[model samples]
Target: MKIAILGTRGIPNYYGGFEQFAEFFSVYLAEKGHDVYCYNSHNHKYQEKTFHGVNLIHKHDPEYKFGTFGQFIYDFNCIMDSRKRNFDIILQLGYTSNSVWFFLMPKKSINIINMDGLEWKRSKYSKPVQQFLKLAEWLAAKSGDYLVSDSLGIKKFLLEKYKKESTYIAYGAYPFNSPNEDILKEYQVEKENFNMIMARFEPENNLDMVLEGVALNSEDKTPILVVGNHNTKYGEYLKNKFKPHENIRFMGGIYNLQHLNNLRYYSKLYFHGHSVGGTNPSLLEAMASQALIAAHNNDFNKGVLKENAFYFSNPTEVKNLLNNSKKSNNLPFIKNNYEAIVNEFNWTKINGDYLQLFEQCMERYKAGKSK
Candidate 1:
């Protein structure tokens, strides 16, 4: 089948979760003899290249920096190009929910959208923008032939909000082959001497609380290394607030997977404080790293980790975990947890689920439920 994937930053997956999802799944589909093409922004420097046996089609969005308007342009062009090329299915991941405009004009094509999260519920956006996003979410679900969600939480939200039933496919992470001794040493992290927390510095992720917790335990033995980009205003604020502290080291956004894996593997414990969203890739990678898991207390994290993880809802709890005499009793649980994630989240199995979803979407389209 000739399939086209639209609405991600780019394919090589240097940035976000959607890009990584597209990159891995597209390659998997291509290997199975399906022709898959992914939309690439010119900013990605993709330049009409082929990656992982899938075609990367580049399109420029001149209004991209304006946020929603830029996304509209990208989505518009992708739909236009897909119609001209006669793709069998057009899958838009985290694009505008109002993209039914594309499917309306196209012939004999399936529209499948991946509802990333409660994007409209995000605290970062203005009230008007949030309301606009809420409308888009409703229209996208109302118009698409099929729907995909990354978590059960999102599935519940969709059902409650829009009364829609979406197929659930949680995001997956690849196995991290343990790195060499010197690799771990480079990060100044011994196997049991430090804890690692890696995530984008956003309000939802609770980087400030984590930093404050680390700062409180100044004399604690376990040094904390926080990895994320400090390039934005929010990021800069956290950097300035914690830059003077000595026990915490804030390493900016890391792009290399190997280096990241090395750091994850050597850590004594993994800290995940994301208060929003469900089943984050970095959290899954930390589980795959065989590190003792400590995460924020919430239904989302608990649903992902069950009894195998620890949780901290506040800075006090985080500080106690550091200052207490407990010797990280979660080792066996962590090992078993690692194995579970390895089996469930391997790119191979996860990609297979995505392929099957696409097939289902096509079957539905043939049944004439394109609305």
Candidate 2:
């Protein structure tokens, strides 16, 4: 089968979650003898023509110059190109900018959209922007031939709100095997002596509240490194607000998976504050890395973690968890999470599931056309 992947910054995963999955999934499909094309921004650092047997389609992305609006131009370019490619399926990773171009998508191919978190509920966007995102979500749900929900919570929400039934395919993770404990030395922390957060500096991610908890518990004084790009306005705000707390170290975005996994493995507690819908790739990676997770209290996190994680809805809860966390209590949760990664969220399983879904889409699409 010939497939085209749109809606990411292209593979080798220099960026974030979608690109990471696209890199892994596309390479897997290519190895399985399927023709795969992953679209990359023209400005993406890895400008090669192909990556690991998968075809690379480079399109002009103006996001650097025009900000968020530039993503629309990039998606438009990808959509226009797909019209000529004769792909069997087009897997759009998200609908933020691409849903508007649903009309232009190739009619012969089946469209499968991975409905990411509920963007409209994010606190960063204004009311008007939120409304626009809702409209985009509705458009994507209505126009897509198939839809994928990464979490059961999101799947339930889609059914309830849009009456759209989607396949529930959560993100995948690989167990962190090569743990270089020395990586902790480079980050200026001892094993199990530091706490960490590996999310973007967004309001909805509950970063401020998490940091507040770390600050309130000053007696422990274990460094809680915040890993992400902190150049944004919100990042600066966080830095300023938490400046007095010496324990909160803002370690700007560390892309190397080996380094990140090592950090998570050695950390005393890993905080996942993403309140967005669906399963988060970082949360999965933290599990695979055997981190003792204290996640934001939400249906999505609870659904995945179940009894394997500590839950927190506010700074007070975060404080309580941090103040009393012990090695004995954390070990079993870490072990169970690692097993979950190997058995449930493994990349091998994820690749197979996505391939099966694509094949099913083809069968259903052809049958509909014949009728």
Residue 81, candidate 1: Cα error in Å is: 1.4
lDDT of 2 by residue, 60-131 (tens): 999999999999999999999999999999999999999999999999888999999898998889999999
Best candidate according to lDDT = 2
> Relative to the unseen true structure, what is the C-alpha lDDT of residue 262 in candidate 1, on a scale of 0 to 100?
76
Worst 10 residues of 2 by lDDT: 323-332
Instruction: Encode model 1's per-residue lDDT on 1-371: one tens digit a residue.
Output: 89888878779886688898888888888999999899887788566589989998888765557765776776677677777888898787874533546445366677788887777667778899888777778778887667887777878877888888988888887766667668766777776688778887778887788778888887775678889887889988887898778768877877888887777777776788887775678888887777677788987777778798778988888887666523256667777777877887677777888889887767766676645
* TM-score per model over all chains: 0.91, 0.96
In TM-score terms, which candidate is top?
2
Error of 2 at 102 (Å): 0.9
